[model samples]
Target: MSLGYFSYPMPVNEPVLQYAPGSVEKAALKKTLAELKKKQTEVPMYIGGKAIKTGKKVRMHPPHEIEHTLGFYHEGEEKHVKQAIDAALKARQSWAALPWEDRAHIFLKAADLIATKYRTYMNGTTMLGQSKNAYQAEIDSACEIIDFLRFNVHFLSEIYKQQPISSPGMHNRTEWRPLEGFVLAVTPFNFTAIGGNLPTSAAMCGNVVVWKPAHTQVYSAQMFMRILKEAGLPDGVINLIYVDGPVLGKVCFSHPDFAGVHFTGSTGVFNQMWKTIGENIANYKSYPRIVGETGGKDFVMVHKSADADVVATALARGAFEFQGQKCSAASRAYLPSNIAEEVKARLVAQVQSMKMGTVEDFSNFINAVIDERSFDKISSYIDNAKKDKKAKILVGGNYNKTEGYFIEPTVIETKDPKYVTMCEEIFGPVLTLYVYDADKFEETLALVDGTSSYALTGSIIAQDRDAVILATEKLRYAAGNFYINDKPTGAVVGQQPFGGARASGTNDKAGSMLNLFRWLSARTVKETFNPPTGYHYPFLKES
Candidate 1:
């Protein structure tokens, strides 16, 4: 059956007796909420110039609860990945030949289309498909994607216009241009924004892309392609392939025509792909570019002078947002001993008050973890933490896998700051709490740095100006994103560039000029009004 957009009932009409003293305000709010809930759809994948119902099928269930099968989609196989790759390669010559301005038009129109018809669909998919709550799915993931597409279009134009001279007298100049081949974009399930940016950046730079989206978010990625097609993107310009990772990895590494790769996933997978490409490098016509954002062990530091309330709230969102699947999630939090109890109280209160349910309800604050594997991993981690002499499970450590993948938002307190959990990338709604003596601020900073193999994100909370400045400068190498008063995961498009270095992989800095550069190459073309005399060029032939 063809799937229409996903829709849910409005969260209106509370029990009259339970309704607060503000009846007039409540009535008005319900009216607006109803209108918004009415607009949503579940879109399908579009590949090779058209939307296709796959030969094989897989049932998609709500990440929150597995009782009801939300929908089933065509399970793309090895053949589909190759077909998509061929489509991308087939269209490359013509697409890359288009003027830069024309290429920019597709992205600009895509942004507008996304801001319109795709918004509700995108939000609904995030909720049901990825286990994100309504507000978090719609407002954060979907909105940020639209904003990224718009801002990146303008940035690409600016990059094109920049010209610097190589010499004063000679008619020599350098120009940045697109790589004249295909880019294979392998994305993650964490954020919708990264999904759009990974492949679209290459498309914006006049390169056709074969994009393999995360299985959990195939629908979200499909809707993205739909918006671009609606925006008048040329057929075959950007191909969407829905195959499993290992199969797609083979095609990407083996294809001699492939020019670049933009990947976001685990460090293990990234290294394997890199090795595969290296093995095939000699046979390829050109040196293929690899850009990636892998795993992270993000941290949050609380100074003695910081407000406990703010730290609690920030840590709540940082550790629990999208159930902590984000690369920038605060996996480890360090607080001063003086404020530890107060911060713990506030965090416990907030978490306890939050509602937990599936996306269909649209009223819950917490939703499902991703799948059975993720649920198992997180639950096992919590179990293992119990065996550690220095570890204690603080708030939640519950897991329910009889249905969909569900894990309670858990917090663990460790006696030693260097506990193994504090050093690793849990990549779930699991937060490790560490308390340090106030005087050992520097020592605590070094502790986090030493423990983590990843340097993707780290933040320090402090009211003092000097403290904030010192933290920023001292921990410069610690994070691609560093937060002060706000949460770390919500990095805006134009303002903050995302990604990191060290084991976190390439610091491409998505949504900034740095990432746009990765999709492009350079060229020089000169036409001298007066032709130079034959022999001598620069220092050659005895000038």
Candidate 2:
């Protein structure tokens, strides 16, 4: 069944709700959190409409308050992974044959469900599972995910409407077809929006998906799966699983039915997957599409003439929000010696004023890093910097994980521009700075531009138009999502379609038509009218 050449509504980004104290949204969120606290749910690996129990459970704990158990989820083995792939392939025929309008409606309705009924539920789950505060959860789990769903459906219609013009005697058109086999979506723990978008984007274009969500993110992912099912997503359309990375990689790469992979994670993992796919290239039905966004050693450069206050606030918000877990988070900074003290003073105040604790306390600006492994890794970087002669602890290098994996927002200043912390990606709330002579702005720009292999996002703060133009021109390739005076984080859908090149994976800008195009393989169809019975062409006639 199909709707009659339906035109979709104009897409608008969902506004992020500020969950301030005493507001209705805040009150609703609190009530939902309380209700969730009373319930201990068992999340199971889902396959072909059945919840399969694997006998091993991974307990879910709030990263901010690690001792408190929110719930636990079953862990899957090879059997379950193969089962998910089998189910998706089995459903591929009917699912792919369904009308595009039918597939579009399911996701469009899911967008509304996330916006209205499932708002508080997803928010509560993201806060507990990811340690995001109320406002953070609102922006990520609810607002951004809703935008991804609505905008993707809108873009699908736009793709289908694109047709080729033909001459008077002939008619020509193109049909966009989904991949012949399954697409695997491997999502990250940082953004709940990413977890949902990666899989649904492929499936919305009429492909089957076997999604393996990060174990740490599975709690909220389970909630998202429930939302899709409620929104009328058919069984076997998207199969959710929980398994070790190597185990899944072995099975997925070797299968002749592997068609594509939509991934967002570490750079190392993406490269390894690429190698495996290349080795098994001869086994696949088609050359699979590989789309990924990986680790970023993102940066911010502040000119001497820039506003110190604006620079300070940008550093505070950009580097520390969501505990510096965003792929675009500004991790390294270059400040001129002229504004060094003023910018440093203002940034210190911002960090000191921030409250750090559990998400239950809405007032807390900082929460724990994702888990203990991350906590230890970030601390090691700080500890190494503290002992190094070239670096000095500027402010906030404290860490305590007695009850939770908590680390204070840290800032390290270095005389050596090549300090370890300045180049490596810590993936936590650690920002490093290198002050340069005001006269050497060009040199400093070069340093900042070349310091990292990853080029996901970066920003320049300047009032000087010439300086701004210079920075913008020189550092153009340094970041995919470049900023003028604003910070590097907080890229909205539609406006700033996000992704990066170089070591940051393929720069397939998500949340846009370019990303939707990746899932479809187009075929051109041509027909001739008033055909002559003779096969000879007019060009063959002898003059």
Candidate 3:
């Protein structure tokens, strides 16, 4: 069927647009945003490449400007979940049997489409629907999504080329096959790129997927689905549905054809899904691949020799960007007492200077949180810290939800290392700081490691080489994505394959070959050039 070996070269990461004032990209993005805001879009469930609309519609609103209407999405019931699974299984055979190069091209074309035709649309939808600013939207909805698609294709290609060695007179080869059944991709609301990557990455490996995105992210999700369709993705290859998580899980987890799940959400939800799968283990066709990147109370550790300005800048950006909704966002920090006062002053001044408002204004660095529920949850911690004597508010603890879910970038100075705000994952623009003795750098490293159960992302900021080395060795298992004198966010696709362990995720490394390996099942074949027809050996006859 195939003639020659095909090689897909490694792809470079997409360049992030600056969206500076008077720039063409900024103008285009602004125009797209205006167009998106002017009309109300009617979205539907994509089942088997057909738009299935139930009358049960949920209103979509911008988190920053909740007073205005964006659009509505038709919500589905439990039966639709069943339909999605059936549709995925029906299309699995043809999709898996298609040539790997064909699959690669489909995603590659999708990447190009995002990079060219639909770049502003992608960023615009994310900016409005998710309350992300122009720059944040560009890096996430445009660049990161494009990077994931291209990098994943290249990574999967490399995976296909890996084979086994052979002995004399024989040959050996390996066939990398997709799983027997369909994959379930459960994506989150925080990152538009994650929403795109989870489903496409699995589907790129020749696996059919039943994708369910966060309700808040459906706007951008639908945009991405349309792009995939235009890129020539086959019917039922990836079925996008809108249903409650429990209802969807009820059907898929118990089904015999449920092969795996590509998930990015909370740890509690992941644990529940794993437990349910374990309960129904005998009902499935294979051991389900439960891959997830869940919650994080990510940290930053500063040494005495670290620059105060550098420490301040890292905390300012790493803790507050995207309203601190990123799982990799630095939520906790341990600073030495030597330069802690100076860092605090600079950080406070920076936080005070940030302008908070809607994403329409390019000048505003801070925007609303995702929703009312997230606002309440994050505000409660700040409120609790206010009442406790052990914790003191450093700056920015105000919150209001009359028009939109807006919370100030709050910082709490805590005497206890394991303070509630430090231990718990408050996924908002809130950072907790704890000062340690300047001489106790190693002890402080241990404190940072032992403070939280999460090991998602963390950084050690130090100018002293010995302090860096000691902290690196001491906090080896503290984080999956560790940084030296840098913030623990903004992981590039090809350079830093992202994921974590210790309740963070399976650490399959999404941007690398390791993730593609999860979707594949390998079979080895060995053949001999000659066969022996004699019943006995020459030595036996002589004896």
Candidate scoring better on TM-score of 1 and 2: 2
Query: Which portions of model 2 miss their true places by more than 4 Å?
Result: 1-3
* Per-residue lDDT of candidate 2, residues 1-543 (tens digit): 765898886598898888776788888898998888888889998898788887799899888888888888999998888999999998888898998888888998998998999899999999989989888898899999999989888888999999999999999999999998899999999999999999999999889999999988998999999989989988998999999999999999999999999999999999999999999999999999999999898889999899999999999999999999999998999999999999999999899999999888899999989999999999999899888999988789999999898889988899988888888889999999889999999998889888889999999999999999999998998999999899998888888999999899799988888999999999999999988897998899898
lDDT of 3 by residue, 1-543 (tens): 466778888888899989888999999999999999999999999999999999999999999999898999999999999999999999999999898888889999999999999999999999999999998898899989999999888888888888999999999999999988999999999999999999999999889999999999999999999999999999999999999999999999989999999999999999999999999999988998989999899999999999999999999999999999999999999989999999999999999999999999999999999999999999999899999999999999899999999999999999999889999989999999999999988878878888888889999999999989998999888888999999889998998888888988888887788888999999999998987787887778655
Instruction: Write candidate 1's Cα lDDT for 401-427 as tens digits.
Output: 776777778899998887878987888
Best by lDDT: 3
In model 2, which range of ten residues has the least summed lDDT? Answer: 1-10
Return the TM-score for each candidate structure: 0.89, 0.99, 0.99
- Model 3 spans with C-alpha error above 4 angstroms: 534-543
The lDDT, on a scale of 0 to 1, for candidate 1 is 0.77
* Clashing residue pairs found in predicted model 3: none
- The CA lDDT at 408 in model 2 is 91
Predicted structure 2: lDDT: 0.92
